[model samples]
Target: MSAQDIARMDTGEIVEYEPVTPMELEFMIRELGARLENAVPVLKELWAARYSAERALIEEKAKAVLRSDARTITEKRAEADLATMTFRRDFDAAKETLHAAEELQKALASRLMGLQNINKVLGHAYGASR
Candidate 1:
C-alpha cells in the first residue's frame, strides 16, 4: 500500500491530516505506541483467564477420554500457539500503525527541510544583489 493508506490509519477518520511538524509527529508516534500497548493487554488477560479457570478440567477430561492419544500440556499449548496464533492480528495492526507513523514523520520532516532550503536559497540570492 502507499503512504497515504498508512497515514489515514494513523489519523483515524482524518486522511487529510493537518500540517504536522516533525516535533508533532514525534509526539504522535509516542502516543500511538502507548495506545497500542494499552490495546493489547488482552493477550495476557486471555491466557490468565483460560489457564486459571479451565486448565485442570480440560486436561483431565481429554486424558481420560483419549487415553494414550492425549497430549501433554506443553504439546497442547504449542499446538494452540500455532493454531490460535493470537498475536498475528495484533502484530500486523501494530506494524501497520508504526509504519503509518513513520511515513507521516518522514513526510513532515521532508517538507520542513524543503522549506528551509528554499528560504536559504532565497536569502543567498537576495544577499548577492547587494
Candidate 2:
C-alpha cells in the first residue's frame, strides 16, 4: 500500500508503519503550544468586549425607561421590568461563558506545561539512545 493509504488506516486496523519521529513530535507540540497561547488572549478580549456591550445595552435601556412619557408610565414600567429581566438573563449567561473560557484557558496552560515536560523527557531519551 502507498504511504498515504497506510496513514489513513484507522487505529485498530492493521498497518505496518514507523512511529512518529522525536523531531516530528516536538514540532507538533511547538505548533500546538503556539496556537493555544495565541488563542487564550483573543478569547479573553472577545469576552471582555461582549461584557462591555451587554452593560452598555442595559444602561441605555435604563435611560430609555426613565425618559418615557408619564402618560404611558404603566406600560413603560412593565416594559422596563421585562427588559431588566432579559438583560439580567443575558448578563448571567455571558458571565457563565466567561467562566467557561477561563477554565478552558487554565486547562490549556496545564496541557502545555505537560507537553513541555514530555518534550524534555523525550529529548533526553532520544539523546541517550543515539
Candidate 3:
C-alpha cells in the first residue's frame, strides 16, 4: 500500500506487513524516510497549534482574573475551554501518525539487517566449503 493508503487505514482494520526482498527493502526504507521528512512541517504546525491552544487557555484565565469573575465561573470556563480545544485531537492524531512512520522505518531497518546477516553467514559457509 502507498503511504497515503496506510494513513487512511481505519482503527478497526488490521494489515500485516508482507516480507519484501532485500532490494525492495532498501527502496521501502528510502520511501519511508522521505515520508518522515515530509511530515516534519505538519508536525511543526501541530505543535504550534497545541501551543496556541495553551496560550488561549491562559489568556482566558488571565482575563477572568482581571475582571474579578466568580471563582466557580472561571473554573468552569477553563474546563469548557479544555473540552473545546479541537486542535488537541488533531495534534494527537498527527503525533501518532509520525510515531507509526518511525516504527515502520525501524522495522524496515531491522529486516534489512537480518537479511544482510543471513547473506554473510551463507558467504562464510560457501567459502569454507571452497
Best by lDDT: 2
- Tens digits of per-residue lDDT, candidate 2, 39-102, equal 6777778688668868866796777689766568787777776667767677777777676666
List the pairs of residues colliding in candidate 2.
none
- By summed lDDT, the worst window of 10 consecutive residues in model 1 runs over 1-10
- Sorted by lDDT, highest first, which candidate order results? 2, 3, 1
TM accuracy, model 3: 0.50
RMSD of each: 10.4, 8.4, 5.5
TM-score ranking, high to low: 2, 3, 1
TM-score of 2: 0.57
CA lDDT of every candidate: 0.48, 0.63, 0.55
Instruction: Estimate TM-scores for all models.
Output: 0.39, 0.57, 0.50
Report the C-alpha lDDT of model 1 over 30-118, residue by residue, as the tens digit: 44444445545644454454454455444544544444333687665555445434444444455555555545555644544554555
Rate residue 2 of model 2 by lDDT.
44
Clashes of each: 0, 0, 0
Candidate 3 lDDT trough over 10 residues, lowest sum: 5-14
* Candidate that would win on TM-score: 2
lDDT of 2 at 115: 61
